[model samples]
Target chain A: MRKGFRTVSGLTAALAVTAGVGVTTAFAATTTTSVDFQTHGFPTVAAQAAIPAGQGATIKAGDATVTIPTGTFSDPVEFELLEGPLSSFAANAPSGQTPVFDFAFKVVDQKTGAIVMKFQKPVMFSLTNTDVNANSMYYNIAPTGTYTLNPVKATISGDTLQHAIAGAPVGWVVTSPATSVAQTTSPITGLPFADWLFVGAALMIGGGVLIAVRRKVS
Target chain B: MRFAGRSRKQLLRSLLLVGGGALMIAGALEIGRIPLAYLRVARAEQTTVSKPLVKVQIVAPPPAKVVSYSVNALYPPAAAPGHQPVTGSLMGRLEIPKLGISAPVTQGTALSILAVSVGHLSSSVLPGEVGTTVLAAHDVTYFHHIDELAPGDTLTVRTSQGVFTYKVVSHQVISVGTNVPNTPYPSLVLETCYPLDALQLVNQRYVVRAVLVASHLTPSSAANQ
Candidate 1:
């Protein structure tokens, strides 16, 4: 019974140490990964989601200098935003101002402009920032990532301009005429799977060492 | 004393068995909730607070591989009595060749059943013809991105007869009320309570209004014509 208890204690101690290491390593990884800049004045919510299966996400026009908010990427990608409703209003889509394509941007990046990480694909998306119901049930299209689409200019897909004249607010309708439309990867990319694994391993080894030495002394 | 010999061995085995079972259960629960919890968390940020009428297909299970739901169709399903004929003169189903958003549009304001459902049917007050095609989705769920739209953003509404594309011109935030429900304007009116969790009607609403630009009658209509 004494031997059994000792073994349990040893294992628990080892696990505790590992947990500690895992935590530290996780923090280290989080810290080392840098953020060049994030100016999400228009509500920081992810809109337009699709599984970036084979073809990957079509880079929206305004999001030229993309960064992987959390995960890692396999390579650097380049593409234009879709031309339709979502395509034309890339950076400023999440706003309430309407009818006119009067847009302004606060462009910021790292001082060095070294955007190493990128968000290659989004498995799902929602354009609504407030309606939880809409986010869950509204017009959601599944991902068609295996597609290779050519970069089309924003003007071609001009659907928003059409909505303004006939459908806008009572006084809000645009009486004037108009038209328009418009992540990451590193070699050791932030592939979420690999990142978590690296964290787990370091924790186990380091924790094992601490528990082993402590047992000898006690 | 003779029975005592086997009794000790049995007790030891039982203890080990019980201990192992407890630990295993704890581990499984931990794994199970990780994903479920993620969806709940994502709900805070990504959730659409619209009417909960749309169908949800649970593709992923617990441990939250479930990130987002896919929109199969937008309009409400047809009823038994020969799905109500869409109100007003028919326009073609709205189709945006770019974003791939295609849905049938009817005359008047939108119905809750019409908000985020399979499709938008004609409304009673405004009718689906040309005036207000008010689309009322639950504020937080489907209409969450309505806040993201600035003026000039475009949306296409396809009627049975023709296709019309509209641009956003203005927006308004109003408290949701049964008395003065906001429906489709001369454009697309996407409105919802501001925070979505506005149980007390405390939060102000946020609205996005857009205008219609081009109305194209597709050749597909001629084939049936």
Candidate 2:
């Protein structure tokens, strides 16, 4: 009787240890890094966030927020401000001419400050005179990398000729990851529920073995 | 007597055996049902076709008289010049006589836009502008015959500002992760997924490089027509 009890106890202890190890491993797999855009302007946020390759990062600028979804980064990256022209509007330019903002920005490593990406292009912003009070401003940002800026709300306010632009933050210009199709494995051939089956089988088998041993003892 | 005189241990053993047998049978049944559950989920996901997030209508070309000028005369004064109104419409027409392709170039490369016409990647330089102007289209449809293009092929873009002509310089196949090449002079880059004959999606991109060779003044009245 004592021998049978000891055997059952040993099996229970083994199963408990296996479950504890599984839980610990799962917890270790996920790592998250958060970035506050309000505290650090885009240049600083881009410089600080340690987004992993194939993963994503989230940015919050005051009331406006955007998510840099997974697969946005082909590799790990940090952003740094390179010497370039700031976005500005011309007051006395030709009436038909759209204002151009040519600038250079770089993506670099957060710790090493090594440059990973650079862009020097003339990005244009158009102003449509909607009545005398409010003008609708429009611009298009096409990403060159594997990153995308989710819909963001920004404000355009400045003097009649030159305005201080806010909410028009530009960073992480890249293509959004394509939606992935979930593939179905042949259930009969590849049982995803095999773990559950194993657990149930283990429970039943352990119970049966205990019973059989008990019978012999009695 | 065997039933009435059964020991407590014997009764406990019988209960354990019965309970274990029942659990094993339930597990087997559950294993059989898993595939069915997975099929239902897969079918649901497959049937759900979401619309493209951004949809911009193709804008009509402006009325302008085509006055062909030499490429040398059309170079912008600056590598990155100030923004000039190129077109009033969101779409421009790209004409490649060599490939017999004349497709509307929309503002964005959304799947919906690519379905019927090519897409002008946003932030890319406009036609006649100095900088790299990147355009993308579906390989199967609009750019199906892109591989037939050769160096020196003439390409024209009719935008709001005017018409611009380009001569193909070279072509190459690049991995998707690689950055698109840029030039200090006026250039055009056409991109599409490669292996034009591939039955499935491929990670390689076929890029065609072209330089501005001519500029044509579009008559204001012609754009209206």
Candidate 3:
């Protein structure tokens, strides 16, 4: 009975340490920022055709009440896009694919079930563009009530996707208020594909060694 | 292999060690799906202001007839019509039946997702409408696919409004600022990097001018008849 008790205690301690380390590593990666209108490039409507009445959007998250802003523009035909939270937008992003985060969407008004606008090209958003490599979501709400989102975490290296997609100096600079955060059901944890690999390797080696030593003693 | 003459205590240790290790490794692998964003462009996207030029002809449909609402509430805060949200994006998917180039299109040019990629312009390019509806697309992403396009390529724009079909009457690459002179026919103008991926002074701007062919404007048709 003592031996069984000893083994169970030892295993419990080991498991706690391992899981704690994983959580700590994850906390170090997720960064958050409080972005205002200026941080997001305020749009200017040079010219636009008049659009009649349209539905707007409202985002409800945590304690923050997020609403769309009326941007500055020169044209009376200006259109307004009220975006929801980045976390809520979805896209067609597949891992291990070149040029991740395809932003293609049809304009829909939940009330009408009507398709107002359709995008022929894919607006590509990359999570690996800044420091957080994982699936990240960004929302762009058009005045016509169309929501286009890039909804996947992908491996984006170098400026190929950035330059090719933006057609100009391109890439998103993420500003997180918290340098890092605890994992809150987010798809990605802190660290890269290599970090976990190292932990696994260590566990395997330690387990093997402990097993070997026990046999010898026996 | 070490199962020989083992005491119960020794056996317990072995099991805990081996079993715990396997579980942790598998869990670690499952956690490896996240991506990292470390690389940056270092420099911002380049935008060169062109010198003021001459007045040009306007062919696009008379600015769409929108019912004017004087109510202050009609225009909500953070609302900019035709304004595209700023995010890391390039090519938008395009399907112009007239243009054989039915694939992903980059956002700079007006034709495909230009407004979505660039500004608030999606509502402007109505297919089969009376006036010329201009659409610009990046020459590189979807346009590179156009390098493979010939004169006879048919272009199509499938929007929430409906599917618009056009035929490429003429295609040319001009300077970035060269706007067509004539009020011109109702058409779709697609722009992109002139020669494949030419980073040089936009070496040339490829313009595909397609006149309206047919449209699936059923809602209006149903409303009229």
| Per-residue lDDT of model 1, residues B7-53, tens digit only | 76556555545554544444444444434433543443233222121
lDDT of 1 by residue, A1-218 (tens): 12223332232222211122111001111111222111111112222233222334422222111222222233332211121222122223222322221111111122333222212221121122111121121110101111111111111122221110100000111111221110000001011223334444554445454444434432
Fnat for model 1 comes to: 0.00
Task: Supply candidate 1's per-residue lDDT for B28.
Answer: 49
Rate residue A62 of model 2 by lDDT: 16
Q: Residue A101 of model 1: what lDDT?
A: 17
RMSD of 1: 29.4
What CA RMSD would you report for each candidate? 29.4, 28.5, 30.8
For all candidates, the clash counts are 137, 16, 62
By lDDT, the candidates rank as 2, 3, 1
Return the lDDT, model 1, position A200.
47
Candidate 1, which CAPRI tier?
A: incorrect
Worst 10-residue lDDT window for candidate 1 chain B reads B63-72
Q: Scoring each candidate complex against the real one, what DockQ results?
A: 0.01, 0.04, 0.03
Write the number of the candidate with greater TM-score, choosing between 1 and 3. Answer: 3
Question: What is the alpha-carbon RMSD of candidate 2 to the true structure?
Answer: 28.5
Best by the lDDT measure: 2
Over the stretch B1-225, how does candidate 2's per-residue lDDT look in tens digits?
766556766787677767667766665665554454445434422332232212222224421111111111223222223242333224467889988776666666655455445677665666665456777876655666777889889898766556778888778887666555333345687878776654345677777878776666455422322
